[model samples]
Target chain A: AQSVAQPEDQVNVAEGNPLTVKCTYSVSGNPYLFWYVQYPNRGLQFLLKYITGDNLVKGSYGFEAEFNKSQTSFHLKKPSALVSDSALYFCALIKAAGNKLTFGGGTRVLVKP
Target chain B: DVKVTQSSRYLVKRTGEKVFLECVQDMDHENMFWYRQDPGLGLRLIYFSYDVKMKEKGDIPEGYSVSREKKERFSLILESASTNQTSMYLCASSSHGWSEKLFFGSGTQLSVL
Candidate 1:
């Protein structure tokens, strides 16, 4: 079974400060990881995905995520936070090809201006 | 840009009412998924269709059904809406590949009274 976990229920950061939302995963085989963001009353929007290759993947809205196999983590990050960047973040895992994604419980991010 | 569109942004229905949620994708993607989002519980997949007329149950599929008569469109049906069924329903689509990423619609907030 593939599962994803987001340790934090909420993360608060000041605008212009760096932000990180933690995620972890468990899978039977190699994992395909993804991060998505959801705004108020809106659907989730794709942030980035880690299939293979580099540990660090940059994505939309100046956000990025680092995949650490040893730690079994894929934490979403941003060099500097913006008030507009506040949203709900989710991490997901897929065990193998053609498998459905298993999503984390979600972490709500609040970037204060 | 890939685009997933849901028919309704918000809806209100009484308990025991039959509910229909429609989704369409303009990207010609081969996979479409239905998920419901709730506070704390996150996004739980209900059903997915990899091709026309082909549907698969996801993590949570009870009391819900889906239809995909056309490749670009997918519909989710609640046999009988209950108070617990009220949620933010999201529609998503992705290409037919292992590493493909998902694009999502704005979501439909269904309130069951």
Candidate 2:
């Protein structure tokens, strides 16, 4: 089974500062990794995904992720954080040939102004 | 713009009552999924459908059942509502194959009393 692990329960950063949320995955074959963000009382929004090719994948809202095969990691990054960027983030991986994704326990990000 | 719509944004149901959550997607994607979001648990897939009338059980499928009668509609059924089942339910759809970026509905906040 493919699974994702998010080591941190919460991440705090000041506005305009860079932020990073760590994610690691275990899968049998080539992994398809994804990042999603959820705001309070709202559904998840797709941030980005890493399938193949480039190591640095970019997504919505100035967010990006780096896929590291050696580390089995896909860490989300933003050069500058906004208070509006604060939300619960999740990392997911889809096992090869499976139709379902296994998600991490999620990390809450809080940006302070 | 593609859209996934849940039948209700908020629902309050009594114990022992049959609960039904409906999801519809306009994108005509080949896959649909139902998931529950709880604090510290992220999103656990309850059920997913890759084709109409084809369903697969997910991680947490004990207390839930799902139906996909049409390509664009999927429904989650709770035989008996329980307090522990109270959580934010999300519906998502994605195209088949690799690089599938899921599109999610606004979610339904369900409360069982």
**Which candidate leads in lDDT?**
2
TM-score of chain A of each: 0.97, 0.97
lDDT of 1: 0.92
DockQ of each candidate's interface versus the true one? 0.71, 0.73
lDDT of 1 at B96: 93
Q: What TM-score goes with each of the models?
A: 0.97, 0.96
Q: iRMS for model 2?
A: 1.4
Across A1-58, the per-residue lDDT of candidate 2 in tens digits comes to 7789999999999999999999999989888899999998778989999888999999
Q: Which 10 successive residues of model 1 chain A have the least lDDT summed?
A: A93-102
Model 1 Cα shift for residue A31 (angstroms): 0.3
Give per-residue CA lDDT, model 1, range B1-113, as digits (tens). Answer: 88899999999999999999999999899999999888887788999999999999999999999999999999999999999998899999999975678899999999999
- lDDT for each residue of candidate 1 in A22-87, tens digit (9 for 90 to 100): 999988788999999988877788899999999999999999999999999999999999999989
